[model samples]
Target: MENGKLDTRALIQTGVFTALYVVVLAVFGQLGALIPILQVMGPFYIPMVCGIPFMLFAARVRAFGQITIMGILAGALVFLTGQSWVVLALAVVLAPAADLIARAGRYRRFPLTLAAYVVFSEMLIGMVVPLFFMRGDFIARISQRHDDAWVNALVNLTPTWMFWVMIAMIAAGAAIGALLGRTLVAKHFRPAGLVT
Candidate 1:
């Protein structure tokens, strides 16, 4: 709080990971388009493996505002890319939560860092939460570009009842991703001086 600025290294690392998050999200988005099920299922699985850069940022950039800034940049990029901004909303919540989790570990605790990434992964479920409350609007919005058949398929595929299933998947995916990230941090990032 004294400086109100991230160190040069932290700033650069945040930019790198923020961009990484966007690129990974974009690739998964294409997969989502090719496989509609990915829209519902991708979050739980994708972050678990793809969050290497994120977990590295989490470990290395322990500045007070680092995670929040990185999250904002990532969210803005997602919105610019035309994905729903709902993930941005979730990032606001998840960023600080991740900070708290990392703080609990004293910033270098591997388990706690992994836990933080799990929180990062949780943001994916937020993408689907709108489906429960704004089903009609979502249908209407999608229908603008997509036909009735596709819209109907999406609606039927992601009913409110399935929200629970999606939540479970998100949790499972987060746990797996966190574990894998921990391994990566220990094996590569730590040795490479990327994470402390």
Candidate 2:
């Protein structure tokens, strides 16, 4: 508690969770590439799968800036893998949102924690939205490296109306995930003294 620093145990837990989050992201990314329908429904998978680690991280760290660090690390890793910087930027933007939710709950409120997990999931999974917002620019960027047919395939897959539909799906996944996290927390983390 001195100087607002994390104790060693908390630091270790946060690091482990952050690494887990990145690994899961990478796995889902590869899976998305392999499966067309899977790629179209990333929101459903990312939030549901990744939200577990996020809730664990939030519970253990229970401090300011932990989510931000996790987001930055994930972003940096994604960038190193040759992905766009925009995803990183979105993650960073939403980190504070998670932080705020955690703070308001004092990091212990199950309901607020669930909400935080939902928002956190949105941060990482929402990166696909640039296609809907900046349609021409996104297509042009993809066209630079990918062939026109590839670009066309991508565009056709992501219809204009599907953007909001995807968001709703993500939110639904988040709710499902947060509920699962709550159950896990009550059954496992609390009993094991992982969360107070």
Candidate 3:
């Protein structure tokens, strides 16, 4: 970043990654629509699938703001798609924290990058926040947007204790995703010299 701002290339890269991340999120999110159980299990697998693009983005990050920008844009997109404001709020908090952590590792150290990803992935917990904190509002809102069957299924699948379980799943999924991402980066990007 020159003069404390992202230049043209970084902006373009951010746009590309942000778009990809949102697309991935949308695609996986649709699976939840088709199979309501996946919605309850989303915290575990969504991060695993999204890790490829994010780690690839992290590999390319040479500055501070890119990941944060991507996260905000992606979070906004998710919010636009009918999720809670908590998602955006968490994105604002987690993205910068992730960026800072990755920066501390110079964006290459495996363990730090993994930790950053784990933290970043937690932004998704916002999706489930309403379930715990605002069940009445969430059910009312969700029922308006979806069929009764889907909403009922989601509500049935998500017990109060499942919140903590989802958190643990996000952590495990993020770590597994980080390993997968690191492996792909090593096997594919490094060999092709796409990222160093």
TM-score of each: 0.85, 0.81, 0.92
Model 1 residue 170 lDDT?
A: 71
lDDT of predicted model 1 = 0.72
Error of 3 at 42 (Å): 0.8
- Cα lDDT, model 1, residue 39: 66
Supply candidate 2's per-residue lDDT for 143.
80
Give the CA lDDT, 0 to 100, for residue 70 in model 1.
75
The TM-score that candidate 2 achieves is: 0.81
- lDDT against the true structure, each candidate: 0.72, 0.74, 0.87
Q: Write the per-residue lDDT of candidate 3 for residues 1-196, one digit (tens) a residue.
A: 1223577888898899889888988898789877887887788889998888888888888578898998898889999998888999999999999989988887878899899999999999998899888999889987998999888888888889999999999999888888888889888987998786
Q: lDDT per residue, candidate 2, 1-196, as tens digits?
A: 2124655665666678889988988888777755556777887877787777777777776457777677777777877886767767777877778778877877777788777777766665546766788788877876897687667667788998887788788888878877776678778888998775
Where does candidate 3 stray beyond 4 Å? 1-5
> Order of all candidates by lDDT, from best down to worst?
3, 2, 1
Predicted structure with the largest lDDT when compared to the true one? 3
Q: How far is candidate 1 from the true structure (C-alpha RMSD, Å)?
A: 2.9
Name the runs in model 2 displaced over 4 angstroms.
1-4, 7-9, 134-153, 188-193
